[model samples]
Target: MPFDEPSQIPRPPRRVAPDDRPVADRLADIRARIDKAATIARRAPAAVTLIAVSKTHPAAAIEPLLTAGQRDFGENRVAEAQEKWPALRERFPDTRLHLIGQLQSNKARDAVALADAIHAVDRSSLVTALSRAMEQEDRRPDCFLQVNIGDEPQKGGCALPDLPALLAEARGADLPVAGLMCLPPAGLEAAPYFALLAKIARDHGLVGLSMGMSDDYETAVTLGATHVRVGSALFGARA
Candidate 1:
């Protein structure tokens, strides 16, 4: 994807889940589960980074979690994050923003400037754009190469066959390739996928494994996930 010409990536339609809860209680429950999973795996409780996915929620919805001491949050779209995070960060400067959705090469600059880590870097053109963006913006965020572990056609990750070359491309461009990221095929037992992603990262000498979400984060933790993105479980349903 050498200079494929950047274009705007449309945001997906919003789908809200039902109900909500006190962020503190929900956050506490999620952390307790994470700690239990980590202990079971003989991994340190501190080894996992819990990323609260706050994509469609409002600033007010997020404030409680911030006050509750969650430092890392994830957004699915760059535009939404740009609009939301600045004011939030103005109030709480220590928060780290993560871009956890399919990113367009066009938004690479904005993502580079805003995110502390990008969890979806799958193509060469995105690699080029992000590398340039980091240089021009004078900010380099950690990157994770998204692998379509289940090889789903409608998903955002790079196909398994393309990963090695893509990794090389990302590194050659001086993108700080932190590790691999993936989304298992939905509605399936996700353990195999998580294990596969961990193996891929291990094979590459990459330590970060950005897998797991509200439903299967514990399984992901058992498989060596360094980061778990939990949303509904932390914020109740979406609302």
Candidate 2:
């Protein structure tokens, strides 16, 4: 059950059946779930920040959750977030935006301007781009070095073998690395991946672990996820 060995990590307990209810009710449920998981892990619930992934959903769709007091949110694309969040942030000035998708080097400036945290800092070129952007913008968004936990080819994360070098490069450039992020391969038990990610973060003395989505957030919480990117569970199925 040691975190370093993903295969030895036990499968997460089966979650209850989905709750089909209003947004506020679902939001409450997810929070309660996080609290329970954190308690079970002997961690404080406040340690987990729930990031409602607002990608693809329109601003109108996001407002209700904002009204319901969900402060942190994640978006995939810089342009979409640029178009959707400015007015929303104007109203809810405390809202923290997280860029949870792959970021292009070309969009580094925009991402630095918009996101409170940039979760997919994978490559050396991107680290340089973001560092330069941060200097120009006078903003240092928390950067999470994404580790391809499953080593999947199509994923947008630094391979496990490459992480130490990438982490060094990012720190050498002074990219305020908050922690690590990852997406466990879909349709499999997620605990092992979460555990693996937790191990990596601990190995590097990083405190932030931004893993978990709607389906497996509780497991992520129990495994020490500081930030959980939840979308469908909060907003319902996307079109």
TM-scores, all candidates, are 0.91, 0.93
Query: Residue 62 lDDT in model 1?
Result: 95
lDDT of 2 by residue, 1-239 (tens): 12243563445554435567878998998999999999999999999999999999999989989999999999999999999999999999999999999999999999999999999999999999999999999999999999888778989899888898999899999999999999988656898889888888889889999999888899899999999999888887676
TM-score of 1: 0.91
| Deviating ranges (above 4 Å) for candidate 1 | 1-21
The residue pairs in collision within model 2 are none
TM for candidate 2 is: 0.93
Which is the leading candidate under TM-score? Answer: 2
**What is the C-alpha lDDT profile of model 1 across 17-113, one tens digit per residue?**
4546677977887899999999999999899999999999989989999999999999999999988999999999999999999999999999999
lDDT against the true structure, each candidate:
0.88, 0.91
Single out the weakest 10-residue window by summed lDDT for candidate 1.
1-10
Stretches of model 2 off by over 4 angstroms after superposition: 1-5, 8-20
